[model samples]
Target: MKRSFENPLIGDKVYFTKYATEPGSPASIIDVELKPGGGNGLHYHKTFAEHFECLEGELSIQVGKEILRLLPGETATAPAGSLHRFFNASAQPNRFRVTIDPGHPGFENTLKIAYGLASDGHVNKAGMPKKLWHMGTIILLSDTNLPGFFSLIQRPLAWMARRAMADGRFKRELEPYTR
Candidate 1:
């Protein structure tokens, strides 16, 4: 297995073991270890489904209006366009595997850029970039969207971010990951 990437939102490490673009693979697999009180807030993907398999410890997953607490060897699925989120509500660390169907465009690079930005102290307390341009750039690059009302502005926001990036204002932040 390859080394993991540090994702502040999920945990200290997230291993991208398999990519969706790999020949014969239909999805991307990610192994994550979530520390106590760490987890992703409500979010959803519009184009790809997501499945989670608990590997160790406990994981709390919210799919739509339902909350599923998964134990070791248990699993759950959230279809595309479903509102979902995951977190470790226990005191102990939790480990799980996530599979994203059809893969997300620039998924790996987006993770790297987010983590790298956090490492550089460029993100806010929620692990999101402090600058709107940076945030928009990530959203556009990864094809990730916030649920509900926030989704309404994603298109225009992405357009502005893309314009900034092209003009060199946000290019520096994406340098390491893009190269």
Candidate 2:
């Protein structure tokens, strides 16, 4: 099955073409179309590796301290625990395919939640949650970490977020994705 979502927060169109739910399959296959100057913040995954292959336009990827400009057919991998981010630094759109290792069900759910929230206008202009509690829930669910100074408070915020979720405040909002 093919699922697609447009995330205004990150200025990207994402398509989920395949999901790895069986043994020995790729975690997930995603096609992304990034608008010019669009990208996500520097973050790291604790348990999964991400691989990116540029399908069209210029894809600028930062892995650790190295910046790579990938063209069509070029690829890069960000191992687990490595700080990385990707963007379209050029004047046009950047299309790319991303593969995640050790398919994570929570990751897919997080994407659906984010996109759904954005569609409902619950996120800011930058495509981030408008509420602090929502942000925390996302962090906990996605298992993504923000590097640099934000790292200091990530844990505490996530803790509070988890508490809020457990209290059932997010139950209604999370229903679509969770179920």
Candidate 3:
């Protein structure tokens, strides 16, 4: 199935427009656009390393406490297990392509969780619902190893993804593609 990640952070700044599904191996191409200072907070993927190629503007990449500045036409890799974050540091806009290997099934949902927490403006009780939902969604989407619960786990995700994409809420959430 095809899906788009509606980021709850910048309100549709970036979009995970296409997803490719192969039986065993996982991979995806993401089109990313970041305005000055726009980026996700610090985080790491447990099993996915995203190789990024800049299509426009400059990007500031932060990996494990070190900052690297990347210009247009440059490429960088954020390996799995590394704490990394990136942002558009230039005055103008920036665009890039992120090719993630061994696709991460839980990446999109994790953004929503982080956005929800940020929405409350503090990591406190108000954001608990979002945090819980984030965790729950991940379990449902990724815990296919559980016995007899595969269908139950996947059904809600399918429904939610469809609804979000159709409503334009998905686009509003991602806010990742704006110049």
> lDDT by residue for model 3 over 1-179, one digit each (tens)?
32444334454344555453545446756777776767755656666687888888887888788887888789888887676778887788888888778665455544444444456442344332343333344434322222234435546665664565577744564323221
lDDT of 1: 0.81
lDDT of each: 0.81, 0.85, 0.58
Q: Report the lDDT of model 2 for residue 47.
A: 89
lDDT of 2 by residue, 2-68 (tens): 3888876666788886766745585877899999999888999998999999999999999999999
Error of 3 at 51 (Å): 1.0
- Once superposed on the true structure, which residue ranges of model 3 sit more than 4 Å away at CA? 1-12, 22-25, 108-131, 135-179
Model 1 residue runs over 4 Å out of place are 1-3, 8-11, 168-171
Model 1 C-alpha lDDT per residue in residues 56-175, reported as the tens digit of each score? 999999998899999999999999888899999899999999998878747666777778788778888888788787778887876677877888888888987888878987666575
Q: Compute the lDDT of residue 42 as modeled in candidate 3.
A: 64
Candidate 3 lDDT at 28 equals 59
Ranking 1 against 3 by TM-score, winner: 1
Deviation (Å) of 61 in candidate 1: 0.6
Top-scoring candidate (TM-score): 2
Q: TM-scores across all candidates?
A: 0.87, 0.92, 0.57
